[model samples]
Target: MVLLDMNGTFLFGGDRFGPNQDYASTYRALGGSRLATDVVQTIIQTCFDTLEVIYNDPTRSDSFPQVVDTLRALPAARGVPPADLALLERVIAQHELGRVPDDYAVSLQKLARSHVLGVIANLLSRKDPWLQEFYRAGVLDLFAVTVFPRMVPASSHRGSSSTKQSVRWGSRAPM
Candidate 1:
């Protein structure tokens, strides 16, 4: 059984979330706010840090507010005002719940042929957001199990830990 990450590992975020592209869409999603290069870096760093906190502690609540609170305190916020945290969450949730690139589908199809696949996403938004993405991408049915924070609140799933003791473990049966 192999566990996969849902956000970046599986979803490319439609190309705005990779090398040298931290929080790319997020800048625009904040509503026409042009961040200075250094400020953008701070925002991106803070975003990742906030997300890690969520992943590290799934039981924690008010995650969106946490991100906002952290950013609001940053010196960068003075130059490039932080977007409305609620709106920020809404925008990210929208992307995660929307279309996945064709490459994701192709890769999933190949991997599913011989192995059990599961999605372990450490999301800031509610679990429904990711489910909406997987369903819209038509790859929701491919996974043996899709674990979200709501379902597996205690999982320390970063990668390949194979904590089979966790929730909803799947098995592959003989044909």
Candidate 2:
């Protein structure tokens, strides 16, 4: 069996927290036109800042709050309807998750013919968007197992080694 990380590996281009991010444009492109650009920008920055705090902490390496929850808690998001907040989460995910290229999908298919493929990804939001992308790329069924942070319960210790083992061995370990 082969294990792989999703971001920066098979998938690329998640730059939501990068310096060149333009949150407002992404928001508009994704049907978010009610909020002003500045407001969108502020909300995006706040999300980034909050995630950065958690990501930068060595002790919090394996823990993360859902991105949608983070967006909902922002002052800039005040009065934004739940539907809009959901859209905002997608906007943030758009910047954070890249696409699976046709070439990579082809490669994955080829690799899966000989080796069992599995995805071990750490995502701040739900895995639906990435799953949709995988389905779109026609590589969703290529994996023997897909594991994301939210799919596993929080452990007392850091890292996901035990969780990975449980999933790989077919243990009913809350995954």
Candidate 3:
């Protein structure tokens, strides 16, 4: 069996708000035209900032909230309707779940013939979107097991018995 991290391994572009990121355009493209560009940008930035806070703090790792829930709770999002909030969530997913190339799918197919493939990914959203992408790329069934674990804080797992045990024997940690 072969274990692999999803992001930056075979999957690319899940990180949001990089230097080249353009929140305004993504907002407009995702049916956010009703809102001002600056307003959308603020909401997007606020979401990113909120995620940063949760990600940087080890205590919050276990209970990391979904991006949509965080947005719905925000003062900036108070006036935004539920539909728009859903749209914003899609926007975030778009930026986070990067595309899979055709060649990568082909390679995975070849590799799966000899080795059992598994995905151990840390994703902020539900696995449906990622699963859909895998299906779209023609590699969904290639992976025998897929574990999308919640972001675990490094300090929490350091030298822990469970961590060592998990490394020795894989577990289907929830998505």
Candidate 4:
């Protein structure tokens, strides 16, 4: 069985893309003024909204690459220069092309005591370097498969806009 994290775990949103304390750091690094959470949230939402449009398109069989393109082209992310973009892209790639959160080990160790697991997140980038970061973060050992952008074709079940697949082991006492 496999378990996924909500938002940044399985999906993408929340503090991962700013809208929190990191917002000021990122905005300042990118040469912007102190922006409000709403502004930061708008940028994040715009990218996702654009992704939804591209992925949900009936004519396009592949949407992951397009999602990558759209994210790189976002105005909020523009002027960030190729180097910085590369860094941000690496973060997206880590999840999209790499492994799940670090916390998965504990859960997996509980279920089956030897059961294996993996991650399948919908990200906005498609690069192999992204996966490398996950390895550096020790997320590659637990999961057998790490589906990410450009790795899996955009279809009903897989792609950059996919959802988390939950796996329920024998019920235990509530937390």
Point to the candidate with the largest TM-score: 2
Model 2 C-alpha lDDT versus the unseen true structure: 0.75
What are the lDDT scores of the predictions, listed in order? 0.55, 0.75, 0.72, 0.47
Candidate 3 lDDT over 1-175, as tens digits, reads: 7877888778876776754578778877877777777777788788878887886787755566667778888888888988888878877777778767888889888998788788887666656788899889988877767766553333445544343221212232322
- For residue 155, model 1's alpha carbon misses the true position, in angstroms, by 17
Pitting candidate 1 against candidate 3, the one with the higher lDDT is 3
Worst lDDT 10-window in candidate 2:
166-175
Name the better of 1 and 2 by TM-score. 2
Tell me each candidate's TM-score. 0.47, 0.80, 0.79, 0.46
Q: Write the per-residue lDDT of candidate 4 for residues 73-162, one digit (tens) a residue.
A: 898866555554444444333323434454553444455245556555544555344445445654445555555433443443443344
Question: Judged by lDDT relative to the true structure, which candidate is superior, 3 or 4?
Answer: 3
lDDT of 1: 0.55
Q: Give the distance in Å from residue 158's predicted Cα in candidate 1 to where it truly belongs.
A: 21
lDDT of 1 by residue, 78-112 (tens): 44433544444454455334356888788887898
Deviation from native of the Cα of residue 135 in model 2, angstroms = 1.2
Model 4 scores a C-alpha lDDT of: 0.47
Q: Quick one: ranking by lDDT, best first?
A: 2, 3, 1, 4
